[model samples]
Target: MSDVTIQGNILTPAGWLSGAISFGERIAGIQGAAADPQLNGDDYIIPGFIDLHVHGGAGKDVMEGGDAVHAIARIHARHGTTSMLATTMTAPPEDIDLALTAIGKAVRQRGKNEARVLGAHLEGPYINSGKLGAQPNFARAATLAEVQRLETMAPLRVITVAPEIAGHLGLVRELADEGMRVQIGHTLGSYEDGVAALEHGAAGFTHLFNAMSGLHHREPGMVGAALAHAEYAELIPDLLHVHPGAIKTALRAIPRLYCVTDSTAATGMPDGEYMLGRHTVHKCMGGVRLPDGTLAGSTLTLDQALRNLVGLGLDLADASARVSTHAADYLGLQERGRLVAGAYADLVVLDRDLKLKAVYIEGERCDLNDA
Candidate 1:
């Protein structure tokens, strides 16, 4: 790879300062910014965003498999995400297997300008049907045999399950033992049930406050457990799926509350019909919703997510951590989600207005115009 140098006010481990980053593939060096009398400090550089939960973008869903992975990666790259987990919705066993197989293939053969496919986040057939928010018809208790089979098929990084389901606590323990992140979501689990899942090794909550129990002053359901106990939780900050006040509450209560797009095929496209697994969804009025008006997913991109956090009165550094650092730590990826020497050359450049100006993935610049 050829050497590439970027000059601007860069956000590094030491904090935001005038600097230049020079790299080939991995980051080679970060230095004081080049002397330019015309420098306005309007241009800024930050580590590329990493999303833990995303289904699709650019009119393709993960359930479509194969090239759909690349399409999603390329589209999100245009929006400054350098890495993400291909989140799968609840579906038939064979459909799930196919999606996993396709994701595994994409992981092994990622392109230069595409975001890295870290692994798969199985959002489950092993959840409560009562809370099946936009998920297709299949919902069942996870079996040991099925879990074992899934482990062998692909790189499974996260699994969202309902601990209240019969025989799910043991399943959580087994998945956690295998180094997979077990999360609580799509369930009717009470506060005690959520606590028990955590006791058995569940790491966090999926899209907190959505498809899960709410915070009752007396009952303290899933939302309460997440805020009161869990180390990490994913929040959709689109202002549609969750209210801003609730976001503030979670931010104050949880130690590490990161953002996830939970974006669907309708993202980055004109308002129209799109696919969310076997279900058809409509994208209109800047949101994706089911025929019956239930929010199917979001049309949010991480760049906009960062902007949203900043708009919420957070400083740039803190906002950056929510979109990148927190999610990276949750996934156990130490080298990603930060701008530093020896890390992968993944970064985003924004203008004074904070609009995306450029994106670099592993030292290669992605063409935003492609999508």
Candidate 2:
């Protein structure tokens, strides 16, 4: 027997259906009729978001280690993220080890009210020092032994590296061979370098146009390479990172472009200084930044990211895919990012204005009031 049922304009892989879904920890069945041809509706039951890159939330930084990842997961769960990667920053070896140890524990002890901690996205240490963006100054070339050691701390699902760094191109191929989703980022590499990384097994670009080299008509930088060659890439749709026009351009060029929060410790908290790895960042004017005004990360949650995509003239279904489906597919998660029988019962309910009404992770309803 099903443990719960919900009625709404449901988003299914086949399309929208006006129906009631029955479920336990996994969906049992759906029974209902078709919705408007346009798929318009005030009430929506869509697959919960899967964020590939998340730093921290609820006033806790992932670098703090310990039970901090649990707190971060709870905050993102309130914002409709059913699953996420506990992204770590460019930091010392000991700090990274400490953070990943905690992330591994969180993955094993996921709370009923928190989002599933899929694994870690190490966005540090193996990057270009010349183009650190908001990352700390600890960038260095990668070694397979070091990466394998870190993976022992937790499943390193994704690792961001700069192709131009000595030996990293080969490392990208090696990591990809070992089943890690390698990405090119924090790079000053040229267009040729980006393409070489892809040829060598890097699967995507990290945060697309930020921190990496920009496109130029004559030069055709890393962004140009991603636009021309990548099948999947992540972009921050917070409107503060990449301009809407630039986002639209990417949409036309890349087939499986997805969105990520790249959120910081200030997420879900008031304007103030917070730690993003080793640096102190300020959250003000709806964005997080360093004191000198370099865009640090963001305070954006996935639910808000969905709204932002829809506002950019995309239909609700397409917007939903960018925030949920694409990310799930990118990570090879089969039972997530879709609403259907046999999939996990992870979903979000939204009212007319796209405000989050409720969220469920693995069929357990989250207490939004406590967030």
lDDT of 2 at 351: 92
Give per-residue CA lDDT, model 1, range 1-371, as digits (tens). Answer: 99899888888767776868898878998888544323565588888999889999999999988789899998999999999999999999889988998998888888756899998999998899999999986999998788778867678899999999999998899889889999999999999999999999999999999999899999999998999998899999999988999999999999889999999999999999999999999999899999999999999999999999889888777888899988999988878888888989888999877899999988888999876
Clash totals for all models, in order?
0, 0
Strongest candidate by lDDT: 2
Off by over 4 Å in 2: 37-42
Clash pairs of candidate 2? none
Q: lDDT (CA) for every model shown?
A: 0.90, 0.94
lDDT for model 2, please. Answer: 0.94
Ten contiguous residues minimizing lDDT sum, candidate 2: 33-42
Candidate 1: which stretches are off by over 4 Å? 33-40
